[model samples]
Target: MLSDTIAAISTALGEAAISVLRVSGPQALQVAAQAFKLPPKLTPRMAHLVHAMDGEGNTFDHGLLLHFQGPASYTGEDIIEFHGHGGVLVTQRLLERLLACGARAAEPGEFTQRAFLNGKMDLTQAEAVMDLIHAQSTLALRAANEQLGGAVGRVAQAMQQEIIPVLAHIEAYIDFPEEDISPETGAALLLRLDAVLGRAQKLISTSEQGRILRHGARTVISGEPNVGKSSLLNLLLGFERAIVSPMAGTTRDTIEEIIQVHGIPLRLVDTAGLRESTDDIERVGIQRTERELERADLVIEVVDASQPPSGVHRLSLPPAVASRRILVLNKPELGIHPGWSSEPAAIPLSCVTESGIEQLRDAIRAVIATAGPLAADHPIAINARHKAAFERCAARITAARAALQSAEAPEFIALEIREALQALGDVIGQVDVEQILDVIFSTFCIGK
Candidate 1:
């Protein structure tokens, strides 16, 4: 029940300077008093140092107790934080005390969920709280912070505002068919709905960038055996993650490692060389390499520049990867074959001397920058939920537009508009089903 006093250890359990135990509910202060012997007279937002106790009232440790008053707290209820010693044992014991003192253990995300329910933030902002925590790069961090600051929510709210007026107008005519809307008015409604839908499509387009920010770009390196694929991987990762050997088929599996190409992270995979192999394991490895190629956002094909080039024919790639592929003529330190000059696009350098690695890194950064929509300082990186909501919202608006154009009953058009508005509510992360009805009742002036 929401009325139940809940407690959770906010900080990860480890030896740190301090660990914080969060308690929130109507009985937060009382629970804190039981666990910490906190004085009845307390000041909101003020930290008080007190000796923490267990259920038996035995002093366990000295800690700071901070109180947040109801209606102003994170969950919009009274909250108490116990800043205790960082030792894992001490933190666990302190938290046990909180639960023993009438506070139940909080479910994962309960606090943020409560904040959403209490009107502290909308769904997007609450989801962004986790995004900010899981941010992997500078761009990802900026996007998450922007979302947390209500960037996406504001967009949804603006979209709702645009939709509601049109919905209200349609409904106004539906309630009174005598006022049968003029075609000019119908055209204006279409324009207003188109604007809202255009914004939805714009947000929907950012889903790719959002996935890249969250998971990093899947960069797969492919080539024949002994073409220095592992060598390039080591150079990028600054360590020997994959074994390099003169023996063919030495690498019979894919090796993955993460490295930052500028600020964006590259989930670099050094796959088994693409080739025909008689051995079963080698053939399986080759098959896996093909699968990785199909899925890769970027494929870097390394070729031996020392060998006389037959032709500059790059490896055949999946249509998805064709535009994102980079051809590299490695081992230039050994001396580039004369025929290699024909292919100017392939980067030429030697892994033996670690030369041209910077250029390769620069190439990677370029692909990530231009290929992704996250080039802006603060991007609208919509997660899965937002993308689905935007799509649904856009679809409903499109349906409503079709109904309006066909001069279908105003009732059907208004129904689609209401659903579209409800879909925007999903974008905001609020799922109150009756909200559309509330808008209809409150926004329309029956007297008019």
Candidate 2:
């Protein structure tokens, strides 16, 4: 595959200003010469207007031609791009001409796969490319960019570096079975092992937040009948996503919408009020609300602020969500009751006036932050694959520590350390990962 020239439509096939078709390989310039004329003095990366022709030398279109020399291109190969008309058929004609000239059709993610194979980036950066494209919120975008810049890879590399010296020391003692490790060497090894173990544990702790960034947080809004739940939902979304009414049980089903709070996307589910109902329809809605509550990552309990403190509706939450709940005092525009007017913990919100909306957003982000070890702005991202690798690395380090503590054979300690190094290497693709390369890159879109 690497020996063949490849061509593809690099831009989306739609009516835009222009669509880009790309060709890259050892013979990229030669393959492009069949359909487009390139001057012998053409400068690399310089744009020029060229007439496109088919196999019979018939002119079809005219556009810009640019070339990126090999070893400096996206895939570390000779690359050429055709900027042609945005019409779908026009773009397809140009791409077909290139393929007919002498270029194979690129498979999904082939461009990035080639980039990875050519040593332009590591596995984490490769995965981050898709993450950057599908990011639902700005915070997720920032996290993807950080990972793309080698955030987790740097940590894994540091751990590997710290373990190398310790491994050499342990292996030194392993060579001589009769001799035991010196006290100073033993202490030094323990210290370095602990240092690497600490980083592994810290990186593993961020796996939860990594999932949250990839997938929007599941947030559910619950309250008594007619407590402005729909009002709050609409206010958060900056539009009337849900119908607002004075009648209780107006909403007999759960309404879901995703809203970005301080750059974090929260999948807000506005549910029917939790109250005793006689109608079968209302009862079913309430049942659905209960199920939604069970799996919610964050629950917003809205209460009427015009009523006395004792009258505040308190919906019983599942034990899992007890600490992850935010109390909202809605309808405060009606007049804050004296009983709870002094309460500072609850957000005094007025959906009509939009007062305290910003504060409520801040509170939501704060509560979610408290739910996990995402204390850092850009926590080390370890997706499911990275998490498993880090877990193996940490487990091996722990085993090495245990072996040292028990004064086991030096060979046993050395073996564990080596395995730990391999596991860590897998995270950054320093070790064999051909099996997972397809799975990771398959999720990427064609033309990168």
lDDT of 2 by residue, 92-131 (tens): 8898999898899999888888888888888888899999
For model 1, the superposed segments whose C-alpha errors exceed 4 Å read 178-184, 310-314, 375-378, 431-444
Local distance difference test, each candidate: 0.84, 0.83
What is the overall TM-score of model 2 with all chains considered together?
0.87
- Per-residue lDDT of 385 in model 1: 86
> 328, model 2: CA deviation in Å?
1.3
TM-score of each: 0.93, 0.87
- Runs in model 2 deviating more than 4 A are 175-184, 278-281, 307-313, 337-344, 372-376, 432-448
Model 2 residue 97 lDDT score? 92
Query: How does model 1 fare in lDDT?
Result: 0.84
Residue 336 error, candidate 2, Å: 3.7
